[model samples]
Target: MVMKNTESSPDLIDLIFKYIEEEFPEVQDRISELKPTIRKEFSGIETYIRQRSMTDRENQIREVMSLFNGRNATEVARRLNISRATVYRCIKTSAR
Candidate 1:
């Protein structure tokens, strides 16, 4: 499968289907048919990945904030390569 950063867990399944479509064209139709069952069977895995991703993201944000001593969201965003809005959103969400 082509590898890249994914925004959420479901993007992973999309990548897998894309890989299958490219590598095994004959199974493309079958893949669609099995999508629901596959998703159901892997629900736990998806949940785990989602949780881990969120935890990692939160930890990263916290680290960046801590390093900056919570001085500036723009600076943190620059260091973290994320939007200032995202940095603020994370901070706000965590605060609650």
Candidate 2:
């Protein structure tokens, strides 16, 4: 549960097992038995979080703004190889 910005998604899965072992030694065996399911759930959550993180959105805006000349979100999107909608969204977000 002590997540760090430097830790990748897979690292969270390993951290969970370590936490369980440290905090609930008696249940370690039971948790190990459910490792596969736990990892699957963690992976899904990681994907969800990565997609929704504000840091990621900010990065997108930074990239878009770097290439923006005030009127070329489409060109910026093409240069960045991202969706036009994504560029537009970043523009809207940065405006706030």
**Top TM-score hit:** 2
Location of the lowest summed lDDT over 10 successive residues in candidate 2:
42-51
Count clashing residue pairs in model 1. 0
Q: Write the per-residue lDDT of candidate 2 for residues 1-96, one digit (tens) a residue.
A: 895776455576677688888998998878767888877765556343454578777887898988888889789988999999988888888898
lDDT by residue (28-47, candidate 1, tens digit) is 77997887788788876734
- Stretches of candidate 1 exceeding 4 Å from the true structure: 1-52
TM-score of each: 0.44, 0.48
- Model 1 superposed RMSD (Cα): 10.5
Give model 2's TM-score versus the native structure: 0.48
